[model samples]
Target: MVYREMETDAEMAMFVKCFWMSDSQNDEGIHTVLPDGYFDLIFYRIDNNLNRIFLTGTWTIPVDVPFTKNTSHFGIRFKLIASEYIFRESIERIIDTSTNLPLHYWNVSDETFENLETFSIEMGRIIERFIPDYTEIDRRKFSLMGCLYDNHGDISVAELSERVGWSSRQINRWFNNQFGLPLKTFANILKCHHAYRQIAQGRFIPESAYYDQAHFIKEIKRYTGYTPKELFELKNDRFLQLSTHDNG
Candidate 1:
């Protein structure tokens, strides 16, 4: 198994976290995928032929994926704010689902779709053509997201509402409309991600974001479907480990 990733171009850095590709010639069996609070546009291939192109939605629970030998995959990991530009409808409609990207979704040419190697090389240009102009983004909401991220999701809804000059209800409405989850849920996912990194690094201190040991365990289980000990003991979860490292 080989996994490679590159940071998004400067122009797209605000919306995209990174672009990644993975190739594996060995049978990896079933891999567990944990919730990471973001969505991805994924391209899959086997034996160098296009297999699928789809958009994965935000997830609140773990998912299992089976990997066969000689598989290759490429993907764009989008920041939460990019939901408006990537999806045609309310994100709430696609939570915990994978929707095939129709022709109209990206308006990409068939030639581009058929030739993934070339497409991967020119991904930045292809993405730029489909991405909405940066000026069109809602700066207020973007800033609010930044505040949450900067605080590692430890900020309260009331504090977020005050900072954004929106009521808690309005903030949650926006969160649901854009990311398919409430503000509190999204924050919890973010908190879990932070805990995941700590655990991955072999440091499992109780962080400020967690109310107590029980709360930490609950959030970990909610996102990963495993307790901290179980997840750490998992030896067949290479995909999950790789994904977590790339996200970090």
Candidate 2:
């Protein structure tokens, strides 16, 4: 089980959220014990086939992204939206795949390996098949999601609609129905996420984490009640970092 985050090709960067690769061993997966509000795109790449597994789940309130825990069911994760979007709504409701139907995950309960494997196979097929409708960039929502991530969660619906060549109102409706939040709210989550990572990766000092160390503190406070020093994980972040036994 190896966890990594890499930069994507510039054109794909905004939506891609850094490609994630997971070679799950007999026992390895990830279950993020996130802060109160969070969302991420877990792009499953199996045997070189790439597809998206979008996860929108909220953290416990107080907005403390306490830690990331990679489970025994090994997998990879691509953090999404920085700090703007909340995952609670999406996890509570089911989002459809191509058909826009509700994705009732409960139908396939734990221990239902057969059904899970079948779905994974089909997902790989969709990525490899690359039919016209499933082209990577064609998924307008992902493109918009990436934009939100890249912009640190400050993009407007109009900008996303224009980029995707869709009507603003139409995109707004779809974005709301699909992601459970207007594009802007989700983007706010990403901004917070980006700031957190900056602090996490040591790129920014605790004193330098706030908006110019002064402005935007209120918004920052909304997500993380304290400054970067309070939330920053010293020693390795307990959750996302992992080592593999079978040479992962």
Candidate 3:
């Protein structure tokens, strides 16, 4: 239930958004819903002279309407990145091309995410360097789909390769260059994300029947170090892990 808008003078044309909690029953995480990651970063344009970004993260349940609100912002998307160089190197890094430490963005603040919020002040100053006209990314490189997200956990590099018309090597390169990780890493991220989403939904049914009776058993086990019953009980921490800069 988080909605944000960038009307600031320096905000980009597109915005970044993250949906941690939602009523979506499709069981798709950010990568499946946005095909990029659990958290989405986008540009925003305004008043013919201003630009900003809508960076966000959110949560969803198992029965919410499909993209009924902001998280599904116009059904937009980004390319998939595995290691998530963004956390290591964010928008400022791209603009400054410097590997300096202490970077905070959107809401990701942690030694894990980016050294906590202590550097927010510095990040604000650095953000000013982003000009109004950076460049438009290729739209074709992304996708948005709320349906079929149920199958995201099973999707592999071979599947994505065919869809993107890329070889496995090329896909790996895309992950490292665009996201800063390898393809397998990204896939593992997605797997864990999907498992967490299902775990969150366990509130609806009997915990015992949920995992064992479902097909997500092994898949969930692979990503997360827990069984379905354990997942339901420990859903909070699992989701917290997902929320902590772990984009699908």
Q: Cα RMSDs of all predictions? A: 3.1, 9.4, 13.7
Least lDDT summed over 10 consecutive residues: which range in candidate 3?
74-83
Ranking by lDDT: 1, 2, 3
lDDT of 2 at 155: 66
lDDT, candidate 3, 1-248, per-residue tens? 22222222223212322212222233334322212234434332222211334543321211122332223221122222101322333231131121222223343322211211222333433433442233433322332111113344346667666665667787666545654445565554454554554455653232332244454565455444456567566543333433332233
Q: Which parts of model 3 are misplaced by more than 4 Å?
A: 1-15, 19-136, 143-159, 177-180, 203-215, 236-248
Indicate the residue-level lDDT of 96 in model 1.
91
Q: Report the lDDT of model 3 for residue 202.
A: 55
Residue 68, model 1: Cα distance from true site in angstroms: 0.5
Over 4 Å off in model 1, which ranges? 86-88, 102-121, 235-239, 242-248
Give the clash count for each candidate. Answer: 0, 32, 42
Q: In candidate 2, what are the lDDT values of residues 170-212, reduced to their tens digit?
A: 7667656654555555555456655655555544432322346
TM-score of each: 0.86, 0.48, 0.40
Give residue 43's error in model 1 in angstroms: 0.5
